[model samples]
Target: MNNLELTDNVSAAAKRDIFELQKKIGAFSNDEGAEEAFRKYRLTRGVYGQRQPGVQMIRIKLPYGYVTADQLVRIADCSDKYATGNLHATTRQDIQLHFVKLADSPQLWADLEDADITLREACGNTVRNVTASATAGIDPDEPFDVSPFAQAIFEYFLRNPISQEMGRKFKISLSSSEKDSALGFMHDVGLIAKMGKNENGQPVKGFKVVIGGGLGAQPFPAQTAYEFLPEDQAIPFIEAVIRVFDRYGERTRRHKARMKFLLNDLGLEKMMELVQEERTALKNKVYPVQDIAYSWKNLGERVPLAKEEILALADAQLEDSEKELFQKWLATNVFEQKQKGWYGVSLRVLLGDMHSSTARKLADVMRQYAADDLRVTINQGYLLKFVKAEDLPALFKALSQLGLADPGFDSTADITTCPGTDTCNLAISSSYGITRALEVMMKEEYPDLIYNNDIKIKISGCMNGCGQHSAANIGFHGSSIKNKKLVLPALQVILGGGFTGANSEGQMGDKVIKLPSKRGPEAMRTLLDDYQNNAYEDEYFNQYYARQTKNYFYQLLKPIADLSEVKDDEYRDWDHDELFKTEVGVGECAGVMIDLVGTTLIEADEKLSLAHEMLAEGVWADGIYHAYNTFITGAKALLIGEGISTNSQHSMVKEFEENFGKTFYPEAGDDSKPFSQLVFSINKNEPTEAFARGFVGKAEDFLKNVKAFRAGQLAENSIPALQELVYGQDS
Candidate 1:
């Protein structure tokens, strides 16, 4: 189809967002004053500024990693046409296309939407891509598939007023079963499928919910929010929880802005109390998830290849070594589906990157051999489902030809690494280059580790854990160590992290030592040798680590940490010919810090407009939330104009009343209530039509008053004070 045809298929809301991006890009080129505001605006729509100037990275959100064969082909075409011809799959199950010009992004977003793909809320302080276990539908042990529920959450929150802007990003994961393959313990909100009995003794579907988990410079395990929350209440509960976060979560201090930090500051009980308060304002108390687009019942008709014919061909065509390898592949990469005769196959994607040509071919293979739904694995691979048992050999042969049939899907041999210095602005060292070296070393020296899936090796470009290094049995995050005159790229070796038991409890890795990047392979060999020779039989890596103690491993690897042994080549980072220099730029992973008082007022106006629109559409709760944000944003803007910074929305409300209540709302300051009470009424009142309309009207008046006050202040000589204020929390 032509670009116009593609654009014709775009949703009205999506088209408006894309057009806004296009306009913002033009505005930025003409006036640099729009940079910070445009940065925040573009990120919410998934356009990210890259390390290199004049280029952008676009992250495409695929809820639960569900992508059709046709969708894959479209993504490949976009990569070739707009971006570099490489598609990078991220750990959170999103695909990223990097090195695209900023001017091309709006069209890129438009083209992808033709395939029913979205870039909305893919970045920024919003609800990110909702992930689930790749084995959701086909897993033999799952109580019921979590895919539908995950999809429901993703849809409900996309463009929802509550999550449009927040202190920091939120992540949710739904695991197929208690095995927690989706790694729920590391998410802001994690749900594990559960089968429970009601008072009538009838089996009911629900989830064991966990909340406030995260990984970054510091990692926190999710705490149990509900031992068994009925499935219908999932979305509503999450909405209430997000409402609390949007109000109270840290905004100015970027480091402490995640939900986990908020949970730390306010204990779980207090947070839950706040969540209960917001419940009255929610659109639904029980939003039932009915069905998903990629449900099993919707798999289109397909003629299965005859079992006898395929097995016979397999016997005749396969050599002995190939047969042995096939068995190993079956043992590691393939699993019997819950649908007796069907199977699921995993293709180990090295470093989570695929060339467009190979991706197109893989899409073809997916169409012919597997179901249309292809799940991007959390470990940065692809999971193909609904393969018949008889077609295994033929499917394997097709994948082998494409060089995607690598064994050890999530084992030690399969290493996960972020783009690092190759593309990411925050990377201090090269995670990709070191990961490749470590993978090669593991294969050449310890190929048998493919049978060991218990030990996972993860690498990240930085301490933010994009590669999830903190969740690996053996982990490495990019860093640098200084020697007298020169700085050498270093890997901070971490051990004793991963899931512990059947419940999949998360353990953040402990930093053991720092070694020069070139010696990473040597460090791996030393750790592996020690684990291999001294561990109790069948003991997991973390178990062995506990027995040896952190000090023992530290002393053992202390020699490698010595800067005296560093060579001239050590000063050069891996895969680079030039001398290394620290080039870490401002990290955008937490989203841009909101600055500029006038811009804040403009954003408040936008929220006021959305409130009016939603109120007109009769979306009461959403309209109310938009109105609520309008109050906070307007108050924040006025406070910023006075050179008074506020951190959280809650703080901003109090600050507004304290500063302007006597002058603006004299009656409220005396006996009735303050500005805080008016705004805080959002959570206290139910979201009825009358309340929503009144709230939206109040928001409009508030913004109008704030803008008038700002105009009066600017009429005086207060423009410099208004513009110079930077909003943040006191350290």
Candidate 2:
């Protein structure tokens, strides 16, 4: 049997045993007297700071996780052609892409927009992507069809005036019936639509509300803020809650500002009072909703379908592929149709991502294949609803191009990942990066890991928990080195994460190992190595990691192991003390982000061991600023979350300036004079030309040979437009 086939029969315990079975599998060759390794970048993926360098988390709206087959085809085409094709299905029933280059984002976004889909405030600190249940009218457990409400909210929130400016990012989830696809309690606001009664005991169809729930670094189990409100009041009530958050929520410290935090501190009663006050004020102001007909579900109208035509085409015209296969798909993939002879077919996608080459060809096949329509699911899957049985293989093959065809849906390794450090600025560790590494590792170590339904891995780059790592079976947070000399990054590797319609909050895993700061691939390998040997039968990585004590795992990894010269050795710097050390004669080094797309967001990236200066463009280089932004947002000082005491020292800048003498900037042309020497020359009170350091630090052109470098000077883009200023410097 091939290696892949060989892994199927091995007990899971054997996989777990492999992790602990070896003490030192390889040795890392230390380069004695060599240069040091440093972490590369960091950034956030939210809207707390407009234009902050962050991952542009695009949420493709899936109304009830249902899209037309054409929509699905376009999504697949875009996935491979625009994004990496590894689309992630969010619990909210949206698809998210990572590694999206900044320049291409607008085009990619336009694709969705062309279809009348949106990319309006998926990222940034606005009302984030809205969520809805997977099963709408068809679910046996549903109360009433909520596809309309979900559609309404999506339409209303797109660049809405009031929704754009929020104190903290907000999330909204709705259940179609009592059995909701989304974790209602985990959202900032939960809405359950139903046919109900009002306080006056009048029969009404409306929504039941639950407010103040969120999951992140600070997980809060949302409580029911309001039991029920009439149907007409749902949108207004939600608006009121959001306005209250904007008015009362803390803006300076993000951690303290989640609606739940505000609700908790104010107490639910007080929160309701405030909500009432906000609602009253909003009533006085003009509302943005457009009222349309609502019939508790078009219970009487029967939507007709081209059923006879579909049967005529399928029964006689299908000349390719297997007929029995098509029949079976019709049985398993078809959904309850409101229209006669019409049905929705669900096509599960494992891992929420698709390959491009596969996606493009699928686009062609979809146009010619099954139903001409499809839909996306929140489960990181999609549905080719409204399709006839005869077109199943063609639809399947087209999807196969996009790699969306995974029959073993919801099994292990169909893991969802939040755009990690690879693209996100706020992530603490490289979530996607590690995911890539772990994918290879898991496939190699246990090819049949997915076949065993017990395992899963989810990751978020930072604590805002965008990937919903909190609810994954194995959750990983992005992290970075607090110190350049340190080997380990600050990681809170959580375990015991899970999600379900019955119970939603997944316990966070333990910090078995710190990320090796920037060495994402290496850190992932270590975690996988540990997982291979320690797990048991029917034991997924999350459960095993949760059950084992931190000490137990630490002891196992304590001994030094030999590694290849290429191995990442983040273990050198793991403690806080190593991160912050004071020394004389050695001037401090710092990096900060000046602009991201175009705006000031965070403070300096973790202090670099050395600072660079570019005369061609003032002091800071474009590359340096890019690198700085990556680390800056993730540094403990920026997030300053509410309940979590970061012990960050952002305001200590004055103290820092006082302790370290303002250093001099460097010269590009001179190779003999290093930055340190130039600083020393300035410190000795030497005369020199002046310069700028991108508005962050003090800059003195401490070099004696500045004239030669400036001789080939490049004109500033902005300054060139000022005719009089450029001609005379306004002197």
Best by TM-score: 1
Candidate 2 lDDT over residue span 559-599, tens digit each: 32222222344442222223312111110011121222111
What lDDT does the true structure give each of the candidates? Answer: 0.87, 0.48
Native-to-model Cα distance after best TM-score fit, residue 508 in candidate 2, in Å: 6.1
- TM-score for predicted model 2 compared with the true structure: 0.56
lDDT of candidate 1 over 1-731, digit per residue (tens): 12332457789988888877787787787884457777888888898878898898999999999999899999999999999899899899999999998888888998899889999999998999999999998889999989999999999999999998899999999999988888888899999999988889999999999999898888888999999999999999999989999999999889899999999999999999999998888999899998765645655434544545555667776766677677678779988777766778999998899999999999999888888989998999999999876778888888888888888899889998899999889999999999889888889999998888888999998899999998888999999998898889999988988875456577788998998999999899999999999988878788899898999999999997887676889989889999999998877775665566778877887898899889889899989999999999898887887888878999988888888878668656355556887899998888999999998898888887887777677758666544333211220
Error of 2 at 517 (Å): 10
Give TM per candidate. Answer: 0.95, 0.56
Model 2 has a clash total of: 63
Badly placed stretches (over 4 Å) of model 2 are: 1-112, 177-179, 193-195, 198-205, 283-351, 355-357, 360-373, 387-398, 436-456, 480-491, 500-731
**Distance (Å) between predicted and true CA of 145, model 2?**
2.0
